[model samples]
Target: MNASLKLLPLAIGAALAVLPAAYAAQDNVQTLSNFKTTGNTKPAETVPQTGTRADALRENLKAIKLPPGFKIELYAVVPEARAMTIEPSTGVVFVGTRKDRVWQVTDRTKRRVADDVVQFASSVTFKVPNAVCFSPDGVLYIVEQNRVLAFPAAQFFGEGGPDVAAAVVVPQGKLIPTQFESFNHGARYCRVGPDKKLYIALGQPWNVPPKDKLAELDKNGLAGIIRMDQNGKNREVYAHGVRNSVGLDFNPKDKSLWFTDNQVDGMGDDIPPGELNHATKAGANYGFPWYGGGHVRTEEYKDQTPPAGVVFPMVEYAAHAADLGMSFYTGKMFPEKYQGGIFDAEHGSWNRTKPIGARIMFTPVKDDGSVGETEVFAEGWLTPNGEYMGRPVDVQQLQDGSLLVSDDYAGAIYRISYAK
Candidate 1:
């Protein structure tokens, strides 16, 4: 063996010895590495995952305000439910979470309600697998902090506990540069775009990335939505200057990209508004730290010149609403006015002095692709007294033309439909 080859085992041993200590020195206190599948999660032990608190759920659902003929009901109980995707062929709803597990919810009886809510790949290890999406051909892609995994023929996989095998498309360490990895804003949301590319949101670790690290961050696809071939090659940033966007969907009519951005905070109660943004062309720039939410500039970069052609938001919501997962309405069950509309989830506020969001909002999209007025579609998760009964995280349309909304706080998903 060559001299260098002879040193391989020693080097390997040294690296093995340094592994745990290196992990210990990592700075992100809430990093995904902290949550192991073994002992850390402490998943809730209860059926209907929301438990038997029927009265509270009923009251919360009752408090919801919707148009006539629209109603809301519990769909399933999924812990820390964040982003959602449905397998059209099998009618399986795959729910992601901010926890250690991904859930597979099935309506085995075709009752339009999920009677079986079970953990997906319960046998596999996962850390903050909060984003799940499906390809038109039934391939499932799961995005976690710093990793992307693919499960072929995912919708047909047997529904057994802790099951399913995943082929790593983007390994954990490869997605984010080591220097940019942090606990904050690491949960990724993904979808197979019209171009048949896998697109994912790679949130920056900070509310605003430091000036010194911006170049490295951008080069690594941090702080933006990135797209690549279905097999994860040729990763490229599609949008930039995005502080953090949890919700995004492609317009079916025109195949444009639209996303909701959670804006900068510490700007007082209502200075910067949360955003509903549209991306018309490739490599679009949505102003972030320079232009905090929509047009409001961040105090840190108040005087700096922003990018010349930064794209602004289509609509702005009240500041700190925590706008999250969204999907364009393609269902026919709702009124004709809602076809091709947008249904978005507001995950509610965490830092504001006055809490807001915690509801589902809708925006109408006209044939000309102009976004009409925005309105509250369903609420009651947060009460008049400011108590949070639930926090809506994502919105996905079911095969039946209804909608499924996920809530992390209440550990449940709700189905919304129209009767008239």
Candidate 2:
């Protein structure tokens, strides 16, 4: 009868807790009372936010708070935009989503306002193609639910659209082992690291899986980040024990890995917090089932001993923030104080009693290259009445030193620029 239980994907929590494990694994997917995710169902009368009205959207932008001399503008109207990457040559921004399409926002006149917003590859059948990045050579890479793809001519030659027949890099069912596909936590966020290797995140499907599944999880490279050669050869696990990291970027200063993890939910309203994790090198494991968010132990794995030498998070944020896409600011547009900092998107909480974190946050890199605590950069999406006008899903910086923040809820991408 708990209010939060109604928001779960399956039956109420109390009812599921008493069910046998055999029945729980009938579909080979386990759902726990404490492991339920924020479901996708909305109220019957929930109006669709398609981001079609430009003038009305600009009026709402007046309320967002940013540091002085900085301004926000309506860049492009992209529905379901999750993570994005920019093509340096043409100034086209490629955006990915959990839906079946990838969007391209172009500024042909160099006016900063996007005049063209269209689907990149209308011919290809995309399934949750939600993360995108560009190589130094201008090749566009898309990481999806079940595979990885590359478009060598994505910028110049493929301007008309991708040729799906020749653009397959990592084929279908090869991203994961194929046995672990589920509707939950398969958001693939990826990029080409400074070392020129392609890094991809494969999230574990269960909320808090049983202890017996850890070895298989490791074997399948779920709950971890993996990297490989540009041709998808010699793929290896880079970091492990990460629970659903939808955002990741290399520190421009160090070229090492840093990411945002959506921690285990349903532990109460405010026990465990969202995490900004860092790994000095490959083969490091950030704590997951043993220590859910920070060091807060989940009720399921409180008794079992976690593997030793587990790495902890560097920066922590408010619980249920759903921190998704992030990038480090290496541009010259923002003030000197804002340089070399990290910008992240908190997609907001769904099941919490009081919803929080429909905002964009910033964290500065210290003098010694350490990460600092999070500070709100752009907010006002979640209104005073706990309703969402927009939910920021990702953040990207362009060649002109401005920033792009995508909101899947409002279905628009806003441009942030600095004048002074």
Candidate 3:
């Protein structure tokens, strides 16, 4: 039986070509093939890289305040840009949006600015495809609201027709149970860890889940970070009790996992601070409902005795800041002090009476792997009138040591570079 199974692939390939009419009628066999994707007939759409809209976004940068010799410019005009993953080998950037489209931005002439921006893998209908990450081997993993797809050699396939080769890592409705899915807090994030395991952040679909759903949420891998083999096998919870973590990366020095947690709201704005947590080992719990953020207790689980050994944030951000994607500085273009630090984007506050945190923050890392206090690296997205000119979603470092910041509100990506 084992030997027959080994030969089944060859037999199936042969059968599909030479089999009788009745055998060819088996549509289910073709549908079940790993190569299948929900293909569309529509041609790929290219976003205009230079236009009035792009100029307006660039002009808005004049209002931005940066340090000494740093400057920001419009890199590309990607609508609703949310999360970004870059292929180091090709320098191609894959950006995900809250909507269905994933964009491919390329600088064909080796210029720092992108030459073209177009929809990637338009054949596949991605639902809230807001998070994307690439493995060192250049495999692109797009984490949608309810599915995860891996495109082998996406840097090349993305340039071809809409029918790019896609492998289902986690099929639709299988990453999480159907009943637990919700649109709110549904934008997922993932990374290929140093161990080569795929780590994904799953947000619980509530301000705070009721006590009844706690057990099931924990059991089903919600409200936590889960890790699995690259092919999506042997999945297990790596961390628990996270409310909603939008950004995560590994510390190259020590290989520890660090993630940003968006805290609960409606608690009068300043009690529970946002979080940048360090997970040194597996099964660590970042306090959530029991403690909203930091040590502040939530109204829902205020009276309950919290679990022992709950890990807290390594650095606490201001409340309601909406901290999102983060990346460790592993580049040489930046000065000595900026090396090994972290750059995190604050998407800004939605409900605060006085809005804050539409900026990029920097946290210095000591040689021992401990973190220092975070400071505003760049600002002016939040105007004095308490309005957001642009909301930065994620920060990605390019191979040249420049940084790319995606703003969903501005529907653009900006490049930040330094000059001595």
Question: Per-model C-alpha lDDT, please?
Answer: 0.78, 0.79, 0.85
Candidate 1 ranges with C-alpha deviation above 4 Å: 1-51, 54-56
Can you write out model 2's per-residue Cα lDDT over 1-420, one digit (the tens) per residue? Answer: 222113222322323444345633431113222333223132211123234476677888887888899899988877787899999777898889898888877788988888777776554557899989887766678988987766554654335433321234566677887778888997799899899888998898898877788888877679988898766768898998988999999887778889999999888888689999888988988988888899899899899888889998888889998999999999999998889999999999997999999999999988576767679998888899999888999899988899999989877889999997
Between the candidate structures 1 and 3, which one is better when assessed by TM-score?
Answer: 3
Predicted model with the maximum lDDT: 3
Worst 10 residues of 2 by lDDT: 38-47
TM-scores for candidates 1 onward, in order: 0.88, 0.86, 0.92
Q: What are the per-residue Cα lDDT tens digits for candidate 1 across 291-351?
A: 8887888888888888889998889998999999999999999999889999999999988
What order do you get sorting by lDDT, best first?
3, 2, 1
Comparing 2 with 3 on TM-score, the higher-scoring candidate is 3
- Predicted structure 3, TM vs. truth: 0.92
Per TM-score, the best of the predicted structures is 3
TM-score of 1: 0.88
